[model samples]
Target: MSRPRKAEDPIRLPVPCNRCGQHHQTVARWPDGGVCGYCYQQAKRTRGICAFGHEGVLPGIIDEQPTCRRCSGIRLNVDCVSCGAEDELDSGGRCWTCALGNVVDDLLTDPATGAIAKDLIPLGATLKSMKRANSGMTWIRQKHVTAFLRNLAVAPKITHEIFDQLPDSRTREYVRGLLTEHGVLPQRDELRMRYNNWAA
Candidate 1:
């Protein structure tokens, strides 16, 4: 006898993926366990001689032996049209990471000048280079976050005081911290300020 599981239990995501062991949203569940997008791509891209004479894209595992998808009767394919990379396609037949990159560019690009503000280039690059893109991707997906970034792209003044005047929230603080890191905003080092005050 076993207790019945609840129907409405909240499903927490970003758990350790069974394959890559990185925290991400579980995309596919195999006999082994849940797999993330990256791990899923890796598994699909696994290449070598199978137990049989087959070679290329060995994605089937049977009785401790890797086999071709056809041989093992596994049917799965996710290919990105833009980059021709075998990955988990998210939109317009492009991989999620690729989509995330495009989104970052669009959000950071200044409408007035049709280019990223010179000061914000580093922030755009940092967001693009993130190892796991979902966190920033998830953030920017929000209507408010998208609006904030778009507004930031056109702001003439990039200063601490200007930022302080905005309505405060976690998203605003996070962007401010990033700006400080890239020298777009002045660092808030109280000890250094105190030392300078004493010297003066």
Candidate 2:
């Protein structure tokens, strides 16, 4: 004695595909799964290949041609800063020549003093400017030079006064040592502690 089946219950039966003639079990009959999965995939792949001749899944179809991600120019290309020559840019966004041009060197030396030109110190023109006679250094301006000289003239007096205000001799000597190392003062043993470990 079996119970009657409900009308809403899904019906499953082997239905032959109209295209490929392969049989598959499906519930719906109206919009029949008449095309098998394999046939559908094959039809999709028949569209076209990319310009690079790769036969696989493509991201988009452009100008009636299929294209992959790599062929579409999606990857970024960074250029050199100075010459705009190389594809790979260095850390400072410049090529080797442009980066090396900024380095402090003997090229900026004064013929008279045999030292780095006084005008090139403390935010002055970079070594790159020395190469050009007509063009000026990009980093510094005439007004900046004026202001820098004014400040430089006053710095030593201010430093001396500050050192005089320090309470102890040891602290003063330590500061003097730092100043001497930086070329702000002449090197001398008087600016350091007199005692040595081996002294008896």
Candidate 3:
């Protein structure tokens, strides 16, 4: 009373089922799935969840020392220039308000006068010598001094200048002082002096 089954209608292949000892035939590879399906689902779920158990993939790397995006001082190691307090920078590194402190300091303590002295002293020495030769007016002639000061006020600022007639001791000492500030000259007393002695 039943129709004959075709050979390939549901091609049967025997596979062991975890739930039972007997093998079963099915169209799909897991047709009689039981404990095997549970195992597969469990594996899928475990793979999807990260170690933190959040439903997603875990990050490959984590940032250990993340600073504030705005200030870059999550730990607050940097000093704030504005309030002179140790605080995070608004934009990391030096804060905006404290950045111009250097310019302000320069304006207040500018070395323009010192620079002029260095430039004028050396060349002015020659002029002083010529004036002395022509007019016999000795010792830092008044006109030359005024001209030297005015010239120094403008450009090529220097630290110290040496005059030809005067002993070079003062110029050498000034230069030594400058060098000392930079921690370059180790010993000031040991420095050799060169001067044009008037009597010599």
Candidate 4:
């Protein structure tokens, strides 16, 4: 007999999702129907008059019309296979938090080694564990942010000197602040530290 499938495992057989009309990994299945993770989440949040004449979150599809949860009795919980989060998942079967973590990891990884720079692991961990999932997700998608990260990943070394030599901009400074805060770069106010050292 085939091994029993876990509930967390997404049905990734590539079927057209009934909700979004995309042929992708479907997480929820009903009678000749399937819903992808993205659509599943959208459906759950949808508020409209369902086919049964009820006004609320219309999370079910019945005969090509939106249906109430009570009327449809559709089950929507599909734990993210990556982090086991019961929250809504992305097309890749990962929750928002896990997806953000992956994005951070990918950005931090050194292009040559296919792993995060040793000096930057702390920053990677810090970014991956950020509490606001939505903010982190949105922040990393900026073109400048991605460009800066890719440049950093290919660098031979990471240090204050390296950052200082780069062009000055708010984006660069912001990323530098996080690096210092997370101990990836040594925390030092160059002027202040120099003054204190000279005084000593």
Best by TM-score: 1
Q: Whole-model lDDT, candidate 4?
A: 0.73
How accurate locally is residue 13 in candidate 4, as Cα lDDT from 0 to 100? 50
| lDDT (tens digit, per residue) of candidate 4 on 45-77 | 566788678876667778878877678887665
RMSD of each: 9.0, 23.6, 32.2, 12.8
The digit string of per-residue lDDT tens for model 2 on 1-200 reads: 12332322123525564444555432222222344444433333332468888654443334645554356432323346767743333457764335545432333344455555343352223324354311232322344432332343334342444444444444345545545565655555552324431353
Candidate 4: TM-score?
A: 0.57
**Clash-forming residue pairs, model 1:** none
Q: Rank by TM-score, highest first.
A: 1, 4, 2, 3
RMSD (CA, angstroms), candidate 1: 9.0
Better of 1 and 3 by TM-score: 1
- Clash number for every model? 0, 0, 5, 0
TM-score of 3: 0.17
Could you estimate the TM-score for every candidate?
0.62, 0.19, 0.17, 0.57
lDDT of 3 at 185: 37
**Pairwise TM-score winner, candidates 2 and 3:** 2
Candidate 2: give the clashing pairs. Answer: none
- Top-down lDDT ranking: 1, 4, 2, 3
In model 3, which regions exceed 4 Å deviation? 1-157, 161-190, 193-200
